[model samples]
Target: MYTLYYIAGIATIISFVSNKEKTIQGLKVGWKKFSKILGTYLKLLIILSFILLISDQFIINYLGGQAPFVGLILGLIIGSITMMPGFIAYPLAGILVSRGVNYMVVAAFITTLMLVGVATYPVEKEFFGIKATIWRNIAGFLISALIALATGILYGEVLI
Candidate 1:
């Protein structure tokens, strides 16, 4: 982490020395683009925090391997509802696993988070038509479920 910062700083310095004007221009453009997404990222962070907090409690209290099917259902529901970038989703999945979330549940959550598009349905429907978009999402949801089961089998969490 610190190494990345150091490398970036050194590279920036070299870039500035090689072409100060171009470096400044690039930095300005990058900052502008990053700033636009920063607010959205912050909002997602808050939402993820609340979800993890609630889920941690639930997992510790009741979900404990005893109700894997219910946990997987919750995972699928939450993942389908929430739209987030993979950068955030991956880390969130790791945190959930560390918090005692079942591998199958985490797999279902991560798979659906990337594949299913409940939150983006409006935009997809506008471009692809309602029927096509709806069918595609349905197919993707089924595929995600399969992937989750595969992940479980690979992890030795599921038999046969």
Candidate 2:
């Protein structure tokens, strides 16, 4: 983050030196765009944080001692719906696994976390259209489920 800030500062300085008028205009445009979406961004952040908190509690309370299939389904749903960065998701999954969560569940969560993006569907639809985005998400979910199943078998968590 600091590195990014440093790079941005340097770039801003260069921009200002190259063309002060353009730099000011660009900054104004950027600020306007950021401000336009600030409310949406805040809402997303608050909703995501609340969902994550509730989901964690729910998982801790009910996911344990449940069947692997149940865990798989729950994981798929959570992973598909939740929008978290990989850095946060991976570490959180690891911590859950260390706390004795089902390996298959973790596998599904990780796979879908990487492949599926339900929360980003609006953006994806903007780029790829509604049909393509839907199909892509469906394919991603199926593939992630398969990968999770394979992981469970390979890890000896599921017998043939």
Candidate 3:
């Protein structure tokens, strides 16, 4: 939050100094553009956000207390399919950890949360060329899987 505020302040100052009149006009244009985008995505965002919330809580309360290896697999499966933002995963993972879920499983889930987002595929392909984005995302997903597996296993050993 602080970083975002600082960046916004800096950008505003820079624009004001660069050309005050132009900056004011640009700010108006930018707001309109952003508002339009928010309006367009509002429904989809609400639906997806709800789904994420339900899924995370379900996983934490139900699947999280199982054996570490089983929980890891479940976490990976959930992470791959979940469209929730990575930012929300941290607290969810913490909750699962408190519920007796292994840290390694949570780590794997967090890794997948950031690396493999099925929901972002269409936009990612459009922005970054289909083949390039798919390959990169796949590679990232694989690396995240490996990291989660290794870290979870290590954490399980240490904590146990």
- Candidate 3: tens digits of C-alpha lDDT, residues 36-69: 6664366556657665666556777645776767
Q: What is the lDDT ranking, best to worst? A: 2, 1, 3
Q: Model 1, stretches more than 4 Å misplaced?
A: 1-66
Q: Which candidate's TM-score is highest?
A: 2
Q: Write the per-residue lDDT of candidate 2 for residues 1-160, one digit (tens) a residue.
A: 9999999999999999999999999999999988876765676667666667655656554545669999888888888887777888788787778788888888887788778977777567766889999999999999999999998999888899
Positional deviation of 154 in candidate 2, in angstroms? 1.2
The Cα local distance difference test for each model comes to: 0.76, 0.82, 0.73
* Model 2, runs deviating above 4 Å: 28-43
**Between which residue pairs do clashes occur in model 1?**
none
> Cα RMSDs of all predictions?
6.3, 2.8, 4.9
lDDT of 3: 0.73
